[model samples]
Target chain A: AQSVSQHNHHVILSEAASLELGCNYSYGGTVNLFWYVQYPGQHLQLLLKYFSGDPLVKGIKGFEAEFIKSKFSFNLRKPSVQWSDTAEYFCAVKAGRNQGGKLIFGQGTELSVKP
Target chain B: EPEVTQTPSHQVTQMGQEVILRCVPISNHLYFYWYRQILGQKVEFLVSFYNNEISEKSEIFDDQFSVERPDGSNFTLKIRSTKLEDSAMYFCASSRLAGRNGELFFGEGSRLTVL
Candidate 1:
């Protein structure tokens, strides 16, 4: 079965700190990758997604992810973080093109950005 | 900006009782999905619906669980018999298309607590 793995369980950083959340998946075929964020008291929102083409995909709120097929990795990165960026980050994978919208999500990483 | 909506932000139910969670997907979305995250666990897919029927479901979605699009706007998940293990946050999501490249929009989750 396909599964996603996020390297961090909790990360704490001061404001303006550089951020990188590692994500890796176990799958042998074509895959779609996504990064979703959930702020306190807010719903989950899409931060970025990698479908095809350029390995680097940028998303909302200055976030980006790189899809490295060889390593089955799609890690999210941000150059400078704000206090508002404190949230739970999830990495997800869809194993094939025809699986409808079923997403296998990783154990979320809790990021706390101190102001 | 359109978004998915879920009702009863939190619900408390007794074990063995039936519970119904409701959701209203984005107006133009063609695919709907249900996912759940138990406290301290990764989010897991339950089911995906399209064209008025279930397109796919995960093993976690057993006989006790059922989904319905009772109307054009409302989609619901019914648990025939709630158990303590059923306590979790349930999220409803919708997308304009199927797996390939569709971006899923998620709703504020409904927290279910079974005693």
Candidate 2:
């Protein structure tokens, strides 16, 4: 079984500040990584995903994540953030072959972007 | 874009009672899943359904739980007897297929409260 670890439990940032959320998984084989955000009253929305090829992947709203195979990490980042970004962020990973691939999610990090 | 939708934003059930959580995944999606998140805990995978059968499930999905797609559109999870620990946010997700390219789309989630 795979386990996801997200070190940052809560993060507070001012508008325009740089952002980074650490995500690490336990599996060593092939895996798919994703970042999902849940605003105060909205559904979970995809931030970005990483499957293969390039280690760095860009997502919507200027968000990006880098898959570091050696570290077993795929950390989410953004050069700058806004007040609208306040939400709960979850990092997930799906390991092994695709047949009914299920996600293993981290404990989630609550991010508050102060205006 | 297409989206997954869930019913009864919030549900309260008594201990030992049965409760069903409903979901309507996006059209054309072939894989469906149910995940639960206990307060302040990681989101846990419950079960995955495809071709109208369960393809995969986690230890968290015991005999007390079952899934069904009665019609072409509605997918449901039934807890035969609710327990206090069953209180959590239940999220429904669907994808085009299992494995490699299966980027899941999730619903707003049904907050279940067992009293």
Candidate 3:
């Protein structure tokens, strides 16, 4: 079975600190990557996604993810973070680009930013 | 901005009883999906429906589970005989099937607790 692994379980950072959450999947074939955020008392929302072409993909709210085929990783990054950026982040992947493929998600990372 | 909406934000039910969770997808989305997240766990895909048929389903979606589009706007998931383990937050998502980047929009989940 295909699976995604998120390296960080919990992270605490001060405002304006850089952020990086690691995501690695165990799949050999082509895959589409996604990063989702669930803010406090809110539904999950797509932060960014990567399909093809550029390995570096930019997403909403100053979020970006780099899909590195060599490492089987799509890591989310943000250069500067705000207190409101605190949320639980999830990494997800579809095995192929086929329509309606089942999505596999990793255990999420809970981020806490201190003002 | 369009979004998916779910009914019954929180449900408390007895074990062995039946429960139906409702969702109202975006007006234009072609694909609809149902996912579940156990507290403090990863979100797992259950089923995907399109064109009034099931496009794909995960192993977690067993005979006890069923989905339906009863009308133009409502999609629902029904559990025949809810078990204690069935307690989880169920999320409904929809996305337009027209583009390569089919970013799914999810609703504020309906939390179910089987007592």
Candidate 4:
């Protein structure tokens, strides 16, 4: 079975501070990685995705993730976070296309960006 | 831009009662999915539907749970006998492409409270 693990359960950062959220997956096949963010009172939205290509993938709202296949990790990073960036982040993995595109998600990381 | 929509933003039902959650996926999406997140837990995939049938489902989706696309646009998740543990926020998602390639659009989940 494929599983995703997010190292951070809660992270507190001040405005303009650098941010990094660690994510790891245990899947033995070609996997698709994704980071989804849910703002308070809002739906989950895609932050970034990695299928295949350059290891580094950039996404909306100045978010980016690097997929390291060897380590089975896709960590999200932001150079500078804003107060508005306070939200819950989820890391998900889809084990190959044959698995019906089922995404196994990690326990979300609650990001609190203070102004 | 078109987006997914879910009904009864919140529903409170009693144990042993039947609960139905409705969703309207994007117009052009070919694949539909149902996921739920218990409070403080990871979002878990329940089932995936395509071609008017279930393509894949997780262990969480047992005989008590079912999904149907009754009409051209509405997709629904029905629970035969709800349990207290079934109280969670149910999310409906859709993607235009199947498998790992397509990006999923999620709806502002329907919160089900089984009391």
TM-score of each model, paired residue for residue: 0.98, 0.98, 0.96, 0.98
* Candidate 3 per-residue lDDT over residues A1-115, each given as its tens digit: 7899999999999999999999999989888889999998789999998888999999999999999999999999999999999999999998754646467899999999999
Per-prediction DockQ, in order?
0.85, 0.78, 0.61, 0.82
Which is the better candidate, 2 or 4, if ranked by DockQ? 4
Residues A1-115 of candidate 1: C-alpha lDDT, one tens digit per residue = 8999999999999999999999999999999999999999889999988888999999999999999999999999999999999999999998865757889999999999999
**At residue A11, what lDDT does model 3 achieve?**
97
Among all windows of ten consecutive residues in candidate 4 chain B, which has the lowest summed lDDT?
Answer: B96-105
Which model, 2 or 3, shows the larger TM-score? 2
lDDT of 4 by residue, A62-92 (tens): 9999999899999999999999999999999
Note the residue pairs that clash in candidate 4. none
Model 3 compared with the native: what TM-score?
0.96
Residue-pair clashes per candidate = 0, 1, 0, 0
User: Candidate 1, TM-score vs. the true structure?
Assistant: 0.98
**What DockQ would you assign to candidate 4?**
0.82
RMSD of 3: 1.3
lDDT for B25 (candidate 3)? 93
Alpha-carbon shift of residue A64 in model 4 (angstroms): 0.9
How do all the candidates rank in terms of DockQ, highest first? 1, 4, 2, 3
- As a TM-score, model 2 comes out at 0.98
